[model samples]
Target: MPKVPKWVADVLENVFSGFNRKVIVAEINHLHPFIKTIKFRGDLSGVNFKPGQAISIRVNETNFRNYTPSFWDSENGVFEVIFHLHGNGPGSSYIDGLELDDLVNIVLPRGLDLYKKEYEYHFFFGDETTIGLFKSLKQVIEENGQNYIGILELNEDTMHYELKTRYGLDIVSSSINKAQNAISFLQNLPDRVWELWQNGSFYLMGNGRSIQNFRKALKEKGVNSRNIRTQPYWVEGKIGL
Candidate 1:
C-alpha cells in the first residue's frame, strides 16, 4: 500500500497475514554505491511467483513498498532482490539499514502480465529500478530459448559493464536524456535487427516520464499496443507509483 493511515495499514496487515511470509536476511551484496542485492530465506512452499511479479513489504507503520525478485529458488526457499538506493525515502532508508538475520514480513508475490511466451524476442527499456524485473524475466526467457535485449539508463557508465558482466545480459546504457537517447538508439538499429524485434514484446518500466516517452516512440514506429507492457515504478516529485 502506498502511504495510508496507520490504522488502515494495520488492519490490512492483519487481514493479509495469511498470505505473508516471514523472511530472514541471508546475504547482502553492495554491487555499487547506489545499488545493493539482498537475499532472503523463508518458507515459501505455497507462494507462487511468476517472472515480473513483485512482493510488497511494509517499510514503516503507514507505508509499504513493492520490489521484484531478481532471483528465486522456490525449492530452497530463497530469493534475491536488487535495490536501487535513490533518495532518502522510507523504502530506501529501511532497506539501507537492513542487517544480517533481520526478519521481514513480505506479501506473497503478485502476478503481472508482463511476460509473453509466444514472442521469440523480448525488448526491455528502463532505468536502475528496472534491473530486478529484467533479471527475473531473463532467467525464464533464457530457459525457454528466447532472445532478449535491453537498454538501461544509469548514473554512471561503469554500471553498464558491471551489470552486463555480472548478469550476462545484452544491455547497453545511456547517461543523458535517457528516454530520447534510447529511442534514437532503437530507431537507428540495423534493418535486420529492427525487423526481428518489431513484432516482439516490449517491457517498458522504471521512471514514469521515461516510460511515457518511450511508449510514444514505440507506437510511432508502428509497434502494436498489445505488444508493449508498461509499469512505472515512480515519477518525479511523487512519493510512490
Candidate 2:
C-alpha cells in the first residue's frame, strides 16, 4: 500500500478521499439521447462540490472521464452523473455493465465551479456531452429566478440523462457539425443570460474545436474572453477522451 504523510493526508481528506469501496446502486439511461445517469450508493456525508466542477472517475489510469455531478440530494444519500455515449471510450464503455452494488473509483471533485452571486441572467451552450454541466447550472439559476438558455446537440434516437426543469430550459439541437448550429443560436437570442459571461464566470466543457468556435462566436459579438471559461472533454480528432 502507498503510505501518505500527515500533511498530505489532511489535504487529501479536504480535497479528495478516494474511498476504495465505493459502489453503484443503480444506473439508467435518461430521457435525452446518448446520455446515462449513474446513481451511487456511497457515503454522502463526505460529499462536497461547487456548482460546475466534476470528479474524475477511473476504472484504471487510462480509463477515466471527468464527470460533472448532475444532482445531489445529500440528505437522501444520493448523487448522480450524466455521461454521453459517443464511442467505446473509457467513460461510455465502463458504464455499460455497471450493476447494482458495483464498485468503482472516483477522483475527488475539484475546480472553480462558480456561477453568479449577484446577477439577473444566465445562459448555457452545450450539446449531449456537456449536458452534465448544463443540468447542474440550470437548477441553481432557476431556483434564483435567473434566465437561462441551454443549447444541446445529439444524434437521432439515443436516450440518456434527466434534467429537473422548473421553468424548464431551452434545449437547442446540435451535432458534431457545431459551427453551423452555434452560429444560429448566438445571432438570434434576445433573452441573453449575462451571469455566465459578465462579472461572474461561465464554465465551458467539451470538444476543443467546437468550444473554439463557440468562443469565437461570442468574441465576434464583442464579449470578453475572460468572461468565458472552458474545460475540454475531448479535442477534435482525438479518441478515448
* Candidate maximizing lDDT: 1
**Mind giving the per-residue lDDT tens digits that candidate 1 earns over 12-88?**
88998898999999999988878889999999897668878899999999899999898888889999999999879
How far off is residue 57 in model 2, in Å?
1.8
Number of clashes found in candidate 2:
7
Cα lDDT listed for each candidate: 0.86, 0.62
Candidate 2 per-residue lDDT over residues 30-110, each given as its tens digit: 544466677776655665667777766654333445677877765666678876777775556777657677876666567
Q: After superposition, how far is residue 207 of candidate 1 from its true place, in Å?
A: 0.9
Error of 1 at 32 (Å): 0.4
Q: Which ten contiguous residues of candidate 2 have the minimum total lDDT?
A: 158-167
10 residues in a row with least lDDT, candidate 1? 169-178
The residue pairs in collision within model 2 are 30-160, 30-161, 33-158, 34-158, 35-160, 153-174, 204-231
Please state every model's RMSD to the true fold in angstroms: 1.9, 5.8
